[model samples]
Target: MLRQCTRPIPRWRTVSNVLYARCRTTAPCQPISPVSARTGWVGCLYSTAAASQSQPTTDGHIEILGRLHPTDSATNVSPTIVSKTTRRLHLQRNHPINILKRRIESHFRDYAVMDSMDPVVTVHQNFDSLLFTPDHPGRAATDTYYVNTNTVLRTHTSAHQSDVLKTRKADGYLLTADVYRRDEIDVSHYPVFHQMEGIRTFDKKKIEEEAKVDSETSAIQGAVLSESNPIQPAHTTREAQLVDLHLRHSLEGMVRDLFREEKDLQIRWIEAYFPFTSPSWEMEVFYRGNWLELLGCGVMQQEILDKSGNSDRIGWAFGLGLERIAMVMFDIPDIRLFWSTDDRFISQFSSGQIVKFQPFSKYPACYKDISFWCSETFHDNDFAEVVRDVAGDLAENVELIDQFQHPKTKRTSRCFRINYRSMDRTFTNEEVDRIQDQVRQVTKERLGVELR
Candidate 1:
């Protein structure tokens, strides 16, 4: 009984009796929000006025478009709509784009060695800066990968450190960089990978004074053998002091800054080879006595500075592997995981704190140079081997200085530069000279050349 009453229906609509007569008849051309018009059962409204508005053109014509309507007659249509022809895109399964982004972002968040705040980047885009002459075997067609005719993928990041130091003005920074080379695939070597370089400078006067002292020492020692020597300055035994205490500090500091969470980290240095850094060193972080060679670093060559516009500054620099650091820190076995496009590998890195290398006791290094005359038939590479075998643990490095035909005999004369050092004490001249004598005897016996 309470619901017995029914509402009366309105009369059939006529144009004059419709809402048009009671209110506005004009349509809104302007766009409206789809959300706002849908309250209760009210129909979504279109902006008829906005649609009627003219869009001006530079060429004198005006464009007018019809108002858009929502799919539901009562719904309001938004200006922005998902086009009927458009579809959401799905990423390729093996695409590295997103992986790289996540890896870089997450790795930096977790790896203390990464320095993103620093805008400066160092790269070996070109190989000419390295002392690798055009004719050298390292730059040969078979030895290196040519990215182009003028620029080869740099064989090492050492090639760019000089440029970075000379042009960079940023203070307290880090550089994530890389180089390219042609090498047979192996566990130790890769054709392409990232390299981080740490570079800093000290007073030039100190380096100049050191250079003067080195020159004097070389002059006294007869310039490591005059004619048979390969000393570029020809008479100065001081080429560039790269293997020093600061180098160890740089490496350990960098590692610690990158891996601060580690309970203990041990880094060591051993004598190594490179055309650019004199007295070069190969650094290894200890993994239970199985030292892994990270990268080589040393003092910038004088020629490097001259080429880079800083002819007078002296500095030390180093290159390290980002992947290696990640591997050690994460205890990951395969380096290829870094380059892997798998989501699992990338997801592992998303959110983490970065760590740095910790400081450790650096082994003291003793410096010595010895000169000898040897037969020209003995090449530098061949002679270095003989010296290494004879000198055993005492030998640090042997360099070729000058070579020429003997003025008196069928024999050809050559000069050898040798260095002896110990991690414990300063080597006496007598001790170093004795080792030099042994090197001379070995050279004479092996190559049949008279000592000068």
Candidate 2:
């Protein structure tokens, strides 16, 4: 007799590797702008509809990250988006975020904390499961960094939600992972950040029975239960209200637990919208005299639940930025402080402890301005990225200070102000000048531009 298979079916273990990436050829380049051959906007690596279908003459040089990544788009890997701190996975151990994450996990004894879910996923997983429309602005190259046409660095931790739900046998999961986005320069914004995704479900038939338990159930007693948020019309008011109550109750408890020490902490619920949920709501806390939005959540869309093989289950999902919460809870001012190698920043907090950060001295900054006439394809994020690469941690701020067009020639000229500062020490004028000079050279060479 043939032996029956003994081992259980493989779960989500193999596909859970976290996403953590260059250029190809340096041939003589030609103009890529549509007006190039006419106006002599030469050597611009611009991509047009036709060019994407067929390679133009000498498009641009491509850089590969060893043999691990292959080129399939305009640019494959960017060092600007990949930082040592990002690749190090700060959420693993000996890190304050990890401490907070573990403590958060302790509160949900039955939920699985997925710390190692892959950060790399297909465009479909990142956008489709989330029900993003095709014209959604988030799909643009300026907003997201792509590995290729089909693959991408996950823009949010929710990318893993569908995969996890479909593969796992558990009723709930919490995902903590690094997410990516190409963004403008500021103290608050970075290309890479951490997010915690929480999702839980209950049997739809059970929810119907629970709706009969009345509004004063122990699960929702201290928690406010108002139908300010919406639900699908497809479901009965009783069913939707029951699911909504449980969602709000659980999330509010988590928020209150995060700031449990402050008995009087101001928290409120605001209705919002998300592609994957109906009548979404955001949780905000009144802190430092301002109401800061903390997390977005809603009852999971029925379509998504069905996709997860949970047509019989009603559930909800919420995602919060770890950096934003940590900054507020710990009183850390600058986002860069989290990556500081200095012990002074890292020593204040021990494992499993939440402490306010002490202020450090601010070093003086040096500013340098570079002006040039660039092709229409020149993006602010691309320029900022190059500045980061050439100047490293020394480049603190990148901003476009000036822009204008010549009336007669119609040539567009723009100036960017790059503030050079060190978190550890101040830079001398000479040292700064040298770095700025290198920045100017590399900016022109890497990005085809005519200096003004």
Candidate 3:
């Protein structure tokens, strides 16, 4: 049984429906008028080019999510990331990600399901609407995939919160979609992963009326709030408390239901921060002797609600990585496995089932280290992205093992160790050496870092 508490325990337990119309492959390709940033249109454009194995034009533009957008100096989205926009693992039947999505939707039975939204969004929609400040690090090309100066592949599903809330359709909704970020390669991290965003709004009048009759309107009792995580000034203490209670209760119930089959499930809440949410906290579940962070939730920023034309509604929103949860629930050891196409991998599970993943024979790993004089503009993620583009999943992990600053020259040197291994086969030394040679060449040519 899963036990939930506001405070941490020694160890332990714990723990969307929406169908958007997918782009039709059979449809003829046509060029549409260029999208304007000011239109605030949040919809998909289908292109026959998306269905073909076409490459980006020699011109300064690239095709993404079925639309052609001009690329610029800030164009850091690699072909590898662009290719994954169409995978839609969440939409694939009988896949683990899809199965997890279905299980979550079953828990939030009444929330509107919105799985189909364009992966491409305007900068305003992805950042400004979420109240992200101009100087936030996530806005950088190194961290996000920019389609152009004004558009990007969303870094998180929260990008759509304002647009969805503006609809005033469902009081509560669940949105599931693939999100992209430039990140290091590891068993647990990937450039693209699925995320489910959840929001539930309460009518101010209705909640106030309930507070009058209910003695326990404050659902989160004894939880501490600090200067950093203070409730919004616009909300009264009672309002914040009531909404906080509802949010925690709903999430706790969902977690309990998710791990109901496991014994001795333990879960806890810890204070956290996000740009769009105030007084935030993260939920962690004890899985296989580790406390894994499962999701983040908090009261929605009041300004966002105002912008959505729902001034009278107070709400709580949460965004969770489906891959993280699926990894824990299915006992899957590698994140890359979620993208595997092998029959042995895909045939093991069916929709609506939670079966442990069966491990195939393990492959041997090959390691190569490259040392280089560091450039001032060098970013680790950029180096990781380069390796990913060169080696794909065969490059399992890239880690910085040593760093030093030249005492006399005021320069820095760094050494990165890259682990080369294939999920389905062992790598020969000569093949790995060839790949390492290419990595060194590209690292110098692209990053301007001199090889040591």
Candidate 4:
């Protein structure tokens, strides 16, 4: 019988429940299956729950399991954005998005499906707690959505890592939520997208002993992992090596299990960097003739462990984009389709279903060009956020059709072509006209662009 360390992970908890981690080990060393590793989804990938800025002004809080109080700056977090097409996509039943999420989560059913948190979080939870340096780009207003100088819309589900780690609720968990980022306009880039964070910490000595036992699989697991993932200088060689083996082996099993249906799947690992972890690596899969990065992970930094009240534990964490994987798995051509509210889009998929998304009759895209004299501080991401805020999912593609510099004034002029289209139905000129007008007016006021 094959023997691998089967660590007993804790039950999942909701946001209202106290979060903490406590783990144990099992003796079974049965041959690993693609799904033998325990996994569960904590919540939705895209949250309908991020604190809203334009939520019909209450106490500036939306009454959720936890009240989402307004901070200072907000985007896409407003009730209008939350109530949009995203609410149609979730991890619950009858939703295709959740159906895909559950495929992985089913492997770890005992774990709690933790609900999402208020996107507005303290700067410490978002950055400092993760050991990000003061000058980190993520801390910049240009890259992250801030609720205030001291609070922000979480850029990743990992923003909750410190808090949950401190609670000691479960040694392993999967947190899924809508994360915000300032991004360039593209078919794939949305200011608000979904992400899931998976992390598991282990007792320092148990893992080392598990490795020392020299079990048949231990040597092979150890050798293979050591050849690739290295130990941190700060960690004891033996402990580091054992933890590394567990981390890589566990992740490999997860990837294989995730794509078990594919007979010709390709996967690889490459060294990478992250502020929170040492000896980091990014997992990539060969898909559609290109290598797409699936996730980023590494051994958990000791300081993070110390803060989480697990000073004596050694562990690992990985974060993945749900849309990235789901898109590939379901043969979805457009990132925006996942947010489709059309009955045509929703009717095809069902609860616990795994079906390739079938495309409906396509509508032609109407393009509108807006030329402007731009400010020195003009950012493409800032411009895209405006388009998203004004047009929501109807804004299909935002491309810079042309750009030039006026030599006499030393000013940059830009022309952007906005492709407006409806996935479910054809757009009338009158309908597109109103939206186009709104876009132009909003860009002028919000982006400080002088319409040319």
Candidate 5:
């Protein structure tokens, strides 16, 4: 979701884990910017193109998490994403995201919970620490929101994995935080979302000792191990099998617990890949006659553990988006509603509860299409970002309705349809047309594409 504009800084009050920003005077308080309401620090909003061109402060730097950061061409962190830095939706008491977080915490009661990590992190921490290759597409400017050449809005909670593992303070831990990504405009896709990373380490010697007491500890059950997802070369087959079994069993059990109320919930695991984890597998659950991927897990890469001074420990790690599960469990049809301040939305949820979301009346949608010749550097996410920056949450969806390539010039012409609608009220045709015009102007100027 995206938003803009600034209002008077206000005092905050928390009720049932929802932060409300209250104005100091009798003047009506605007909607609380989630992070500002919780942290008592606010930032002025800027459009993506404006933010890219102008620094937030006179010093040619931007204020993020109460610190100044130098900006350059690499600075792509928009004010919309900046505002989400401190939202901490997972920490909100009655929010569905938090409810899911607490439910998982209940299943892993002994795991240490870490939820307050800063969203801004060094590129090394966000990518290199997790073993992402230098040329990986995720590192591209179009996909990531870079604070500068060296920092970024952490794309995943896993960015903190290496640092957290270094402490070696907890045998198991659960880290939850808001994660940012440049994405499409759709009901399920949003630029800012939340994730929870869970890790559990086991001392090989202890596992070996326990295996003698209980043979089942070393057995891999109901899982087919293939060459494609083999144990790492550095790990003993027995230890790897043990850890893999523990990982799958733990996750399957947690899923069952989360969906215990549903009748006959079915889950299956499939082989997967990730730069940081070897022999990875993704868990998916059958829901509404479709398969919904729930999370990804694998035996921790040996190098990661070795780097953390735990060469002797073998472990399993998994990460899941709280929003994905919450949406499915709560029947939330639109992702933007999660960020809404509407009483109708908030009143239906409570801490420790799993209730289906009842959507309020939806306003009509206004459609506008823009056709343009593709530029060499154009990316779909760039177009989406422009629409988000210009239209904010009012832009419900953007779809590529038509595309064609000119045979002689070898140039591509594409058209996108933007669905404009207000969550609270109807939009006049003039208002939507005006917004669409801004989108066209921005697209041409920022993207360097020719209007068709």
Candidate 6:
């Protein structure tokens, strides 16, 4: 057997349940596989050394989990472990009996069912290779967990999308089963979590045109399109946002159908940010007039697309927390309840029943924009914070549309388009202008900004 640890083994009751539910048999629960048994032994041996973990001293002795691999080009075993620390930290996990678990099985079942006929149906990938740039914080020893030598637990399922795109068949739909890491270990956050990442590529010009039309539809709401009311460049600034919004709505709709009793289900798009997506968005579900964020999505960045050999085509993708959705559906407040090992919680949940979700608008949203000039001492971010404080709930989207440095004064000028539209009622031009004036005053007082 591989090295083994004496510490209490985590009960695999949840894992067993998952296997039983999906496989409908105890085949996977039998004797440990030969390979797994070997790995267990290795883990146990390493655990004895590392579990005695102690703080490193200036003398330079560091803690290591296992010995160096034979392929590492080192024939001699070092007496001391090398020390390297990273600044960035990440925590990741997946939960037991949680919504995410249920969803994964659901998707897996659907894929299996569909593949029986098409065989070309996209399926989720489980394991993925991980590479961190030399400068990447994740590469630092202090920031991540080391699984064996080259492999580490995946942080997010999306991490494998690039790998799948490069290796998998290029035709038909493809999905990946991935997980990611974060620092928080709380009721809501697990050390690992599951994510579904999807990819598709086609003619760019055609997709771009389709995106242009969708953008208009998204921005106008219920407005009817006509020759006079044409979609403008401003409307299609980010096709990814609109496309993501579409996907979110469709997903939420399907979720509601799955739980037939749910009602008034609506998906609202809110601005969000992430490194991999431009013009990213978070989808919120309206619950009892309160909004709860449910999912994140956006168009894939060009760099990621190029790396996947789809540089010539456009791509879009998204990820959602299954637990968060389940929480909203079941009115569960603390995420820990799902993993509490409490028989009551699990028994209370409806296995295959639909729950009703009523949608209602509590507060109206308003948007406005202002142009101003300021010294190099302040930037758009600084200005946005000030606006957020003054506008409160009345403010919708605040963005820097234009920026330039003065050729003569050496000062900077920024144009911000602030939107003002309330769910309650439309605002008068005068009312919005007055609020704009207040924002301008705050900017001037705080950052020495001058209204343009």
Candidate with best lDDT: 5
> What local lDDT score does residue 423 receive in model 1, on the 0 to 100 scale?
27
**Tens-digit lDDT track of model 1 for 1-452:** 00000101010001000000011111321101110000000111213223211112224322112222112211111121111001110011222222222343343342223222211112233335655455544444333433234333344434445556556464222444333332222122223344455555544546444333333322122122223213335113443332244445545555544545545866655444345544455455554334444455555455765777765555555555444444445544332233333344444543333322231232343443434455444445445434444543344444456666657875665665565544234667776666666666655665565555
lDDT of 4 by residue, 228-298 (tens): 45566668876766666666676666776787776677767655556676666656566555654566677
- A best-first ranking of the candidates according to their lDDT comes to 5, 3, 2, 4, 6, 1
Off by over 4 Å in 2: 1-67, 74-76, 83-90, 209-230
Clashing pairs in 5: 17-93
So what's the TM-score on candidate 4?
Answer: 0.79
Backbone-clash count (model 1): 40
Against the true structure, what is each candidate's TM-score? 0.43, 0.80, 0.85, 0.79, 0.86, 0.44
Q: Report the C-alpha lDDT of model 3 over 3-83, residue by residue, as the tens digit.
A: 122112111111210110011121221111011000000112112223121233469888877778887765667666787
* Residue-by-residue lDDT tens digits, candidate 6, 233-313: 223434444444444444454445534454666555544434455454445455545554444555556666667776665
Model 3 TM-score (2 dp) = 0.85
Q: lDDT for model 1, on a 0 to 1 scale?
A: 0.37
Per-candidate Cα lDDT values, in order, are 0.37, 0.61, 0.70, 0.60, 0.71, 0.39
Which scores better on lDDT, 3 or 4?
Answer: 3
User: Per-residue alpha-carbon lDDT of model 5 for 1-452, expressed as tens digits?
Assistant: 11112111110011100101112221222222211111111112235355344224456687878988888878877666676676777888898889989999999998999999988899998878777788776688876788889999877777788899999999999988887777677665677777778898988889765323233652236446688887888888888777777788788778889988967887777676666666777666776666655666778888888987899888888887676677668877777778877778889999999998887898899999999999667888889888777777887789999999899998999999999777777889997887788788878887889998
**Residue-wise lDDT of candidate 2 within 1-452, one digit each (tens)?**
00001111111100011111001111322111111100000111212222222121233322322323333653433644443323534464656667667777777778888877666578899888767788776677775667667767777777788888886578788888776666555455556666677888777778766433345633444223346545676566666667777777777677778878878777776555566777666565776556655666777788887887777877777776666667667776656666666778777878788888887789898998999999988888777666655665566678889999999998899999988777777779998887777767766776789988
Clash numbers, per candidate: 40, 10, 8, 16, 1, 49
lDDT of 6 at 7: 11
